[model samples]
Target: MQNFLKKLRFDDVPILDKASLYELLNQRFADEEKKLSQIPNPSLLHDAPKAAKKIADAIREGKKITLVGDYDVDGISSTAIMIDFFRQIPYPLEAIIPNRFSDGYGVSPNLLKRVNADLIITVDNGITAIEAAQVCKERGIELIITDHHTPLDTLPEAYAIVNPKLSTCSYPFQEICGAQVAWLLLGLLKKELNLNIDMREFLDILCIAIIADIMPLVDINRTLVKEGLKVLMSSQRPSSLIIKDFLNKSSITSEDIAFQIAPRINSAGRLEDASISLEFLTAASTNQAYKQFEKLNSLNERRREWEAETTNEAIKLVNSDDTIIVVAKEDWHEGVVGIVAARLVEHFSKPAIVLSINNGIAKGSARSIGNVNIYELIKQNGHLLTKFGGHKMAAGLGLDEQDIDAFRIAINESASKLNSDDFKSLDEVIGILPSSEIDIELLNLLESFEPYGEANSRPLFLIKDAQILETKTFGKESSHSKVTLRQFAHEKKSIELIQFKRVLDIPSEKKLTCSYRVVKNEFNSRVSAQLIINKTYNY
Candidate 1:
């Protein structure tokens, strides 16, 4: 299944046997009004109006309008949104995505060396660019910052800073990704310029950013993703087409976005300069899109290699006694450390931070489990950290190499206050889908709630007490399998299940209970509902 995952979208874990899962789904369905009729006012975000007006004035004054962005998926998507919007206006624009290795994240002082513009706007980043903002002030550049990351005690000195996370912000939703901030800024910009541009024109890209950034899929985020995914499926953009063609499926789901699309877009940023992704998203033609698409695939492969290697080494250094896992090593690719942190959290079911050391400076990424605010944990030791900023679930930080041991001890000591129950992984299952009930109609019913992600994930159903009647193994190293199972409780109806990353040590008993997700299996031009095994249990 590991190799199959590499070849296709295979993502999952844990199970809960609960009847209230149905009630929860019912309540969610009854409250379809979660979809807002109108998006929240952009002016509600602190400084949005000021930033939009400043940008409009820049365009009218014929000032060199430059947009700066970060290198992550949210950052790349934000830059792509501005690129697409300006292109639609037929306006000449200069866009910059800081190189992770060279320019560092956001509009930093180092990145300022390459930035030359009269009016510069930052998207998805710049909330913490205190030094860079001071530089812009000293250099006579009009800087407008639009970011969603939580602001620190001292804010940047940009001319207009638009971020909903600002303490004074009255925006209805507080937990939006960076690209949302960027897109809303464009919405206000449209109003300021009195342009006929429809802001909905970019949700196809916006959806990708929201999912990739792991924003909670509820309220405005859900509304935007649902609408954006529809546009993405039907979008004529070369990038969208490239994705559909690559997946080879007519119906695109949020899982496809999370597992298949987002990774490829993020791979370039993780392993190389994010500008490669910026180019891919804004590809002008099919030829251009495919040309960049190939590069993304190559980079994605390399990212996987680096991530696996680092994860293996980091796992060996894990201290099982600690509440939080902090692993640091010399020469691990800084670009892949974040992913390594996530892998560690997944493996140990604990919060983790992985740092790569170079020249006596350690920089790395942090990933948290449920209810553990990793950003806050890292912030608790701010005096030890040279730099750090992010939200609850994830963050990045830098510190002197000598402080690694103390930082680790301090963070873990702080983590001791957290409830142990919060560390337990919950795999919510919509229990008992009889083999006979698994069909195209059932799959369609499940997919009606599109764009499943954080806070609103795709429902998993249990097929209990199934007898594994037959099995066939194939794929790389026989790591994939096709099995026929019968549920005696359902009059012995049989279903074909495809399991990826085959379990190494199943109980000797032939009877097994499995929790699985319904996926369309296309073989020999025939499409049918099939189960993708998430976890198998013998009880």
Candidate 2:
């Protein structure tokens, strides 16, 4: 890996130095390993206890309840939690997931006309539905909103609103996602009723939502994921029969969620209907769950095909000289634009926006790399946008056909003035590892860094003078690559390491420097040392 590290250079990254990288990973993993009895619960900001109580009373009385959920994993997982919790109370409950392209976002008048229930519960959304809640109020429908997104200036008039982002809320950590909020709601219910339901029973579902929402894996989130993965591995949770079937055959990890489960759940929204995933999660019987699970698996296969096509097109758009890329194509599926935006951001190593253009409007998704804030960028140009809102790293926008060119030009101008050095390249020196430290003990110490996602990335160690011993591509389409690397780090001690999915463009021969993590690969009743490559260089 000596040759590979030679090519690494970052001209201007003021905050992140080699020392900082080491400290970040060491401190992060060390802190995560110390498990807490429970995460410090954020107090309810708004005085909505009465509303939650009322819903609990309704649930206790066996009244009909319906939940409105978003069409993504966060929404689905939240729905699953509430649905499973309500089942214990033996309450009549149902859920609805709006079509992403048609219903837009949040509770709408169109949706109110569809479901006939005594009370309505919204998950992962509905923090800013003034008019829709008004309609529900007029129709005598009580609403309980469990969301974590920022609220509007005037809160909606609902039966009860539970959101961590509320200004008046006293929640210690205001950064939780909607599924976590739903999990909290369940916790509240258990406390009030003094139910003996196993607290860890639902962690597996929460883990899926936690990873899917891209929330920071710190604070209370870390505990949830830490314990959640344990419960999932034990196969003790109320999960879909198909999920259990898969887990029984193979060991599950964070990698399983990213590569296996989350994609299948997300595939529903990208390709067909997201309701398929919700049905699978909340299915009444193993037979029903199997059918739904199979359907989601098939849908995920289609999603892969669609994403491959769209990514190719997005890569072509990157050849342009603009600081920000805005690409629109009529054939692209709107639901998958966010995924395409993410893919483009990785490929170009810059902020990117992907739009599905049809008729006279463009609906798009934007993703940022490094320190670029797409939300702030869009807010500066909000006047030109028909609708736009999101967090720092990701955003969504709606643009009128007439103003697309102007918006693009304005964003490009803003991007040009920003310092490009911060993101000129992704050549980061993660860690420098002594060759002697590449052993089972080191790999075991790394286990403290569980439930890695977003900001809580896996630790990457830099090692020098590694030679590629073998290279092969696996998987049906040859989309995955596996390699064996050999390096002599100490006095006459040779280390053989395995790396997975290193890009083909990466040269195979010569001394290379690699940013990697040491992990244990257990196979054939033996545990062997392996290196998971994050980035490599011919330094």
Candidate 3:
């Protein structure tokens, strides 16, 4: 492990030695520091300031405000953030999240009709909700959209639009997700009102959303997480106590948020009720928050079971003929299908569509690999879909059962029209390594690449031929295997590298090449390093 990473570093790969690199990272971090100063953030377009003024006026006048949030964690967190911020002002506000089972995604026309509010703010979603916005317009309810999805050719006719992707908009970073948009709005509000509130308080919540939403952790996002983690570690955030008690970690990292907290936040919507997560995030007392946190933990465990089983079943249905992977199961829960689709795309190195069939209408989530654009692919075959919306890499759609075959052919056909080789050619498989390289210092450098998700992926290193020295299996059912490898490739240096979850499939006496990440493990009051295997091949 020690010699492996150094051997893997390439000339073209970015080095920290350059002044520009440090300058850029510093500037980006500074920009994040001063984010709150830019109230009525200049990045947003089309009456964002006007909408902020309206919201501020509503607060002063004590008018009722209803928040319409989407179904995902980003939406829920955005909802919770709004609720938390407003409650600080102690403003009169009510939050309404659309149900995935009942109201479906986006701001539902029915949901809007039922709510009585002078001002309605939509988070994580609403830019594409043309008809629903019209309903709000007709009912004399002012609508403000603070979404971060790709805009349509024609935007919704609403009171204000605040998406970064709009061509007319001047937002510097267009790639931010919806939760970030909500954070930006909050930043603007804090600045305009001359509020003395700590900016880092909101950033702690934002760190979770940033990681949970799988947005790129580059530029502004990198800074948000960098400073957000500071606030979290300092335990200064007033709103993160629920999350604090839930994990019970002495120190919080972005990885903790992504793997531990975000999933729990998301589990509510996936397994049962989204409101459980909202309640947990906004819980006032430690006891109340702990209860909700425990519930979310239970829901997350169940969600994992469902995801693992559903993905295994879906993989069996994938045919070798299709350029893309399309699999559906009627029994699959609609909420977790997106996650399953993402897993399939990652495992198979192909675009994947996981669908949940209900009432002859197949609701599906699509995830892509590399440069493949699932949204554009769906758009090209627009006639086959009842409705679809998303960015290039991900999308959601509804299709009729009768059109399944044609839909498959059309998507595959569209994929075939492009360079199929382009998708797989980028995939590189590397060798096994000596374990000594996985030291605390390198781990620190790798750890610096925090808040990893989506575009900013975790560092993956490759190692060449190492011989397996020992093998063992763990877990109640022996479901996981761990292997130790030995290598003395670099002269008088021999090291041990552990390959986890590979003992069952791998033979003990064999030479293998592997790719992995270095993770530090503390046991028996001692610290050592381990290699988390990514891909391996036996020789």
Candidate 4:
């Protein structure tokens, strides 16, 4: 655990003099507030108004409408938002989420064949559904696509398409997630149809999608999450309330969604059909929501089991000399490969792809580190792949079983050409703090930067030369450590520090330098400042 200190990079946040702390705080808050105030209008999104008008026309004409969504948290949340909005307008609508195994991803021809509707709207997917869009066109089904994925050179021929990343799109913020795009569409529809629906009702779930999809929490995203957290804690939504109860959490935070709620929602899609998650989010009553929550919770547990098994097997296949880790096995669960790939990336600090071999085809998930664009790398070897799509950090692909070795060799060669700095581990430190400065007042000031995620990460500070007063190990496996420390100038003031999944061997007589983040630990209705240790240097 202590070895992590050697990889630390304290360059991101310069150490500021104590006298300038207040000025720095004020400047950051002012900058964030200014960015929030300049959020762009949804009207700026290309084809948004056109899509809204088409949707309104279908509802007015009583044309049968079906929503086609992906099998992920973002897609499920997008489907729920649209379903809730349609219910308010008293419009009968049908929703369908693709099954990861049968339906593959996005709007497939098989999925489209199963649906019979005059108008088909796709959320969170359809940006790359060229053939599926052709099928819809031939079948005379009107298609309106609302997605946020990176677009290819030629877009599908749909009735209307709304995506911020479109080459023609002038929307100022292109990094918004799928659910936010759905929310924006609903905002326009509410106005075009003169509906009196409160858009804020959807933020609680929208916030989850934004964070779960790893969208940057800045500008409009920051506002959505900040406001969404308030709505989530109010417990007005049955789904949110049930999730909170299941997790035994008194209040919801960005961390809660990232680690707890999102995984449960995603588990359904990963293990079976994602429609279970959609049902959970859109359940009409508390009892129904609870039932769905229980089902999702069970699925999540199974997912964890499969993920652990696959991760161990994949790790065994990693070669130390390889620039990229590519592992494949027969009978491995396809649903858990993505999680396994991510774990490999974390453990090996390199790009990794885990494939599940079934019959003669290999379906895999790839995860990247630092500057490596996994999507671009996979696309570069497109000749060997049957299907591939995703962003820079992560991607999914399929290929012939025979090509696995060649594909692995190709990606590793590409990865080897990159600089070593791209694969180095660097811990971003905010600033240095003395024990005297560790108090509730400083923690409260840090709270101003709420809803931390991708871009706006939680602040981390380095505390130098702190003497350990006490130490203890806990948890089922005794893998967690709790310690009390004090600085030289403030020997009387001791602070509690916690390190999860790591058991530290520190002597009370020695002083250590620690990098940590300030967090508020709540217990029995009381909250206090606590330090979450990320790395410790024995000096």
Candidate 5:
């Protein structure tokens, strides 16, 4: 997302010196060890022990156990975690992620038609499977649901429902993603069966899911991601090996996983069957992993193309005066609607819902900007929606094609109740800094806050009075630019910053204030300090 940043000044917090900066940071990051250890026991989740016992009975009885997973990275990772754990027991289990084109999201009646099993488990989804759970009950298939999404007032009547957001849930941390819930339940199952499985072994993939699902990077999530990055750094997983080879980097960071890896895994589900990603992640051979990665990469490229086209069309539908943006096209690729909604949110600074109409139902995704809760906004207009589910910042829903106009107008009317500030951009910059401070040390200070996402984000610094020494568009189609600039702080230090997307129109005077992020760039065994230009304000 291109950022037009608002300055965040800590006037009383001193950071010009190391001691004070460390003090402030220490205060921000209180009790690292205590917080890291706060990942409570798995049994704390409601229905965990019962779910584990039932699963253990199924495993012992040699019953057919099928895991119904969603299509996103979280769902795939949750399924992959199950695959990894079950393979250790030498217990064969069936795993399937819903097909975006055919089955749509989560456990649906359409998807259950393809499942034939004695035991069925849902990961990352099924919280809203009121009808599907009923179908399973009628079929006498034991259902176990493990999810992290916010549940409805009426829960699924399954054998077990484990969700952190459940009103009766006992889990301490509610922000964990679906894979974490899946991993936790499996952890309890391992205990029930007295298996010697090392749960940390799954962190490498678990971290990917946590980041991909947009879980807040704090407390339990922080520790897991930190450890997961460590395992990923030295792990022998074929997917990890292939990613390292593809990126030409010996180490991977959360940013790398979020930007480079998550999208690839998500691309499979977005445009095709997520099973491709599942197979790729659980591939037995590096060569096999390479093939799957190729497919994912290609699909990701195609997703980008479609997303650009869809976003362009969606942009035409936006009305600047609308408190909330609602846009839909008859055949907009449903896979890219969420991204288009997110783009509209970022660009227009309004909550957006982008839908793809086909048959007679319009289904798609919603993204919010600032403080507007997209889920609540949509829920307020639930009379027009056939179905809707999500949290504060994101959601997915569907309604009748005829209700699209009503939804648009109704949702905007609902949004009008929100404070005016709710529609503004959430981007933030931590005050100003001299470009001369763009050294390895300052980069390290930022790096101290590893695994930035959700609650914790990489800090942006405003560099004022920078002289653009040279600028030229790079990359295919001139999609990016490499700008060399010297700050007024020191002419001796000129830095290269990359700006993505449409090339910026450099000021005729070649002077501007750049909102940038300092990064440690390593390439071909060389390490250097660089910056990423997000936005530039002209004088």
Candidate 6:
């Protein structure tokens, strides 16, 4: 018999029955009521009200307002939210998304030298743009910085700065994404100017940023995503509709945004300029949006090809005995290294860093598994790094090519001293349910906890002693399997289970235990519950 580990249990959370599980989940996972009202006053965020007033003054003075944004999903969404808001007020606003290759991550000196504006407002970035802030000051352009990244020791001397992570800020939730921070500032701006604007219209963009940036979906984020998903489903937004149609999704979910939409949007910034994605998000016409979507789709295909090629090369550099994996190669695409690092972590279950070498300089992205603080590890070796910044689980850095080997050794040594428990495989099973209990009703009930991501995840269930009646292989590469499963004791009731990217061999006589999730499969105007098998053990 295959050993089945009961990894997670809600014994501490009081639950009388299946009907009460929702309440239990809410009690345990949700920190506060997920309502718009639950969001704290925007003024509580450091300089948010000041930023709003600055923006209002700039509008009144008829100053040219330029928006500088980063080139990621969060940054693009933040820009889109601001553009959508400004459209209501009839302002001549110019938006710029810095090219990853040309202007680097944020508002750089290169960008400031070209921009001609009386006022510059940076969204999703600027918290780390110390030199750029100086450049803006020198150019006599009033600056407003709104971002969500962790601030450094000394903040930039901008006209007004809005970031919840600031030590002086009193916002209850500090984990919000960049778009949410921008949305909050816009909300304050709307109230200050008494502008008749429906702020809820921008929630869809906020939802995309929150999920795409991998923010923990709890507290206000949960509420925003919950309501945002509804708006997205009913939204006539040209880009949203085009993307939905492109993916052939009948209903939008958090997973759909994370897996389908975010990747395509990110591909533009990754392989090319992010303006394509920003244009797609803010496209006013269906034709324009569709054209942008097709372009992004093509870019995503190219990204996939590069990602696969780089991942293979990265894996070859990994040693079986290494606790931390660091690989560098000249001519590797800088944009795809982050994805390559993620794939390395997933495949090896270790913290990994992938660097692209150019002109004796190495630029790298790092990803961590378990509780490893990859950022801290990189920071500890700051002497060897030219630049580095990121959160605990992920980071980006630059270093001299000669320092790559030394940095790798130092990071691996640091990782080795950490707890071995961090490296252990942990199953994230929520609970077990009998095959008979799996139905559309249960799926609906479970979906009440919608907008799942990061901290708030979709539930995985274990089904034991299921008999496999039939199996078939599908997909273009014949790498997918469709198996009909039923309880051993209850043979009449069968469930169709789908497994992606993995071909399984199930003997006709052998019973299996499976870990799966219940998902609604829609086809030809009909919806039915289906099991998505994550893993299976035969006994």
Clashing pairs in 5: none
The residue pairs found clashing in candidate 1 are 1-479, 1-500, 1-501
Candidate 2 structure quality by residue, lDDT tens digits, 156-253: 89888888777777777777778888777777777766677776778888888888777778877777877787777774333544685764534556
State which candidate has the highest lDDT: 5
- Point to the candidate with the largest TM-score: 5
Each prediction's RMSD to truth:
5.0, 4.3, 4.7, 3.2, 2.8, 3.3
Give the TM-score (vs. native) of candidate 5.
Answer: 0.94
Report the Cα lDDT for candidate 6.
Answer: 0.83
Worst 10 residues of 5 by lDDT: 1-10
Error at 255, model 5, angstroms: 0.7
lDDT of 6 by residue, 1-539 (tens): 11323322222222124665566557656344657877788788899988899899899989999999988899999999999999988788999999988888788888888899999999988887888899989989889999887777788889988988899989998988889999999999998889999888888788999999888788888888888877887789998778667767666889889988999999999999999999999999989999999999899999999999999888888876788899999989999999899889878778889999999999989988777878887877888898877777678899999999999888888887889877643435556666566777887877777877777677776766677778889998898999887765745787788998778877566576677877777888788787898777554
| Candidate 4 residue lDDT tens string, 334-391 | 8899989988987878889999999989998998887777888888888889988788
Give each model's whole-structure lDDT: 0.83, 0.73, 0.73, 0.84, 0.85, 0.83
- The number of clashing residue pairs in each candidate reads 3, 20, 12, 0, 0, 0
Ranking by TM-score: 5, 1, 6, 4, 3, 2
Local distance difference test, candidate 2: 0.73
Off-target runs (Cα >4 Å) in candidate 3 are 1-46, 236-239, 242-251, 420-434, 489-503, 507-509, 523-526
Residue-wise C-alpha lDDT for candidate 5, range 1-539, written one tens digit per residue: 12222322323212244444445445656655434346799899999899999999999999999999989999999999999899999798999888988888888889999999999999999999999999999999999999987788789899999999998988898989999999999999998899999888898899999998888778889899989988887789998788777767756778889889999999989997898999999998999999999999999999999999999999998887788888888999989999899888877767889999999889999988777788888888888999989778889999999999988999988888889877765565555555455577776776787778777777666666678899889888999988888866436877778888869788888876667776678987887777788777654
Please identify which of the two predictions, 5 or 6, would achieve the higher TM-score against the true structure: 5
